[model samples]
Target: MRRVESLDVLRGVAILGTFGTNVWIFSSPGGLAAVLGGGGVVESGLRALSNGKFLALLSILFGVGLAIQHSSALRRGARWPGWYLWRSALLLVEGVLHFVLVFEFDVLMFYAVVAVQCAFIVGRSTRVIRGWMIAAGVLHVAVVGLLTAALYGKDVVGDDAADTSRWLDQVAFRLDNALALRAEAVFVLPLGMVLFLAGARLLRAGALEQSVRGDAIRRRLMTWGLGVGVPLNALTAFAGTDWALVDRYLCAPLVAFGLLGAITTLVHRTAEGPLRRGITAVGRSALSCYIAQNVLASVLCYQWGLGVTGGPLWTVTCFLIVSALVTAGAWLWLRRFPRGPVETVWDVLYRAPQRISSRRTRCPQGRSA
Candidate 1:
């Protein structure tokens, strides 16, 4: 399968928006509490604009990437998800390291776990895949619904937002609270599965194509997802911590679909340009940019570095500055290198096992030539 520019564009959009979503956590003195509990008006509105929507979009794109890998494996007569497991394992390791050292809200580990599950079924028949999607959807709805109902008139107010100025202490806190820190991933898994499968199906259905059918699909996604999903999300967003589950898990993904649809359509109509190319370059270097952004944000906002959590306007400004730097850095890096620095490192890691296996097969150490 050839690379899809539209998908790349969509990915670029999602990447930056994810930065938009996460910047708040890094900015506020309240940290995650600001999001989990309620912030002031500006914070709430800013959080509402970009929050779970981009994360959900990322989930769908991840699914699309996994499907592509599955297809590539079939094309080369490679075993389905045989070596993919190694890839996922590498991602898992990366995620773990990232969580321990850099950021607590890393998504790579969860994506790695879901990728393993999705890999097995990506090549299944349409009916089977659809069945899995439905099951995943039902599970997600049930879990979120129950949680939201239970939290009705309640709260998830997090602990003291100010981590000690020492970064290591923050790491220690995350380790001590590992289960609690990682619990959101457990709850978000079912929806992740659903979005993953949905992304694959959408790609196969040619939702990115410049055709009547594609347009029709995107229109529906835009109409229902944005048209209806936006209102529902806003309602929950400003309400309170009681509505966080409904806002993030349920309503936000609908807005994500709307975003995916609208952005893809924009990609279709637009021509190549510097701005477009830069975003696509960022998309190509997404993993690098993703990690880099978090690290940057941490140094800028955490108690140890700048140690200042300003108001919402300052927070938004920080987000924009960080995103612009990341974009420019990715674009500049890609100009000379085929891949981002991290991606280059990842490719090296990916190839090492294959090289070892090939040598073992060819040399046959026990047998004389």
Candidate 2:
């Protein structure tokens, strides 16, 4: 009902949903390679449907959140521009730390950098913003599709063949790729800003606030997201296994957005129940839970905790179970604390430091000044 609660719920879902896709990396035989369907058809299919679709959904929500933050700032008469820049910078730092120290795949820092690019446009006219969103989404898909087609034609078949040089090349290739794409800028940051703009536009148009539109739109989004996500995902599974036509990066984001909209609608429309409560609780501590899940997952799969590296599909499933439990545990812990540990630090970063005067005021000394 409340804004923060609504956002927290969505953020929580996005965080967990992201893990839903990432867990495959933790529990598969070839690690991430297996989850990418390098192992076999069934595992690959499962991973595509689970991970691809879920991550897309998470990305779209990231956009929605950007809008929420901007809108909230404007509503309170706060000078949002400067504050957002600072916040984005803070996130960038956090993201970099996450990448270098904890995980090489960290995306936040990139997103933080990307967020700066669109700082000026978020508050612009909805039509203009919408145009940019459409253009970016379409261009991105087209480019990816073209690239996939070219690779397919070049016989660049997706293979798990172990090549010593290939492994070495991957690092260099990813670095160059990251730079050319402005990896975070093109892939996530822009997409998120666009999505946030759309969400804000929708909010302004009363899409979420209006009962009539809410019901109609929610139902439609849910239907379409599931309808398309299921079949296309099936196709993706088959393509990855048989043909390699399905580009997860390209198709997944679209499917995920539809699914996210659908789910958001369902969450709001459905009576508050266990599922809602659980998700909301998790959402409340989303930041902490998000980082925690990654850490927990890493330990489970790394040469650490269970040393369950290169495990089977079943093992990955177990990792999911454990991760979910950890999320629930974190949610429970937050019941008393109100915010996750990292979230608290984020708050400190975003909020002004408190000042306690050390100088004591001597009683006016019977002061008749």
Candidate 3:
């Protein structure tokens, strides 16, 4: 089967782009404070872009991929909905493992849950898809408002920092944050599903596969991204200057989209040189890279490895450099092999049964199925 090079490119960009911000946490004084915006301009700008913009790009790409895979299954006369559901279930399982073992901030499981809804919309028209996307976006904004009001209302009602150092209190705090984050995931998941279905619809319409059509679509998205994404992000940065209300929701997604637009446009126009090919390679093995990065970051920041907690922006920058080297090295190593180890495992779990079934059956061409 032909590979979707663009997906790889986009995934690679998303994974690496995320590090541009995560590095701050690894290198700052309290780590969490840097991420929460107590750091300087360098760290703040990085956070503005990394936290939302890249993530949105990833979500959009996820939608596009779901559509492509579903469409491909349809062409093969396979039951796409069932297969995709199974696939998402497995991904959810993977994501859970990732969250529990590594970071609660993991998004893969939430994406899987949201993407299950996309299967139902596989055959929807573009207008329907676009409308759904807009609704999802609006719903996200609404939820943010409701949550913000709830948190502040509680504070207004005298919910103070009663005690700081109790272990039970810390555990409770972590649990509360986990619940809040999961709740936010519920809102964001639908948006991802909408984007995924939209991507599939665009694919079915041959918008991405045709050069002229793809270019036109890219241009339009780019325009929207620039006109909307850029200004919102800049405004977010300004609002975030004091870490206030407006900065929390709008800034991240807008910045993420702007960066995604810029990178996508660049890739679309590039000469596909060694750097581009390398990015494509990293993107191809994106799942592995995503997992690998956390593992590496843990080593760099956690109590285990370097133990260099809270240094400066430049230190975080070093982590990014280290991450790139590690990613490049892993990507290069995988070039000699067909599938990444993690991807191979996922394939085996998801597809090996079919391979076994094919071996036991015969085809009309006097060959194996």
Best by TM-score: 1
- For each candidate, how many residue pairs have backbone atoms clashing (under 3 Å)? 0, 3, 7
Clashing pairs in 3: 28-310, 29-310, 52-252, 53-255, 53-256, 54-256, 63-196
- Candidate 2 versus the native: TM-score? 0.80
Q: Candidates 1 and 2: which is better by TM-score? A: 1
TM-score of each: 0.96, 0.80, 0.82
lDDT of 2 by residue, 135-215 (tens): 866776666567566666354334442221233443444454445424434455445555555555555554454377766
Off by over 4 Å in 1: 161-164, 364-369
Q: Give a tens-digit lDDT track for model 3, residues 1-369.
A: 355546677788877776655666555545543355345676556566565667666776787788777768878988768677878888999987776565556778878887888777765676777787788778866766676666552322222221223434534544556665466577666557655665566455544442777666666666666777677766667554343334545555554444554665676666788777767766777788778877677666555456555555556556666667756776676779886778888988998767776766645446533
Off by over 4 Å in 3: 149-181, 202-210, 241-251, 254-261, 355-369
Minimum summed lDDT over a 10-residue window in model 3 is located at 155-164
Q: Give candidate 1's error at residue 41 in angstroms.
A: 3.0
**C-alpha lDDT values of all predictions:** 0.89, 0.60, 0.65
Clashes of 1: 0
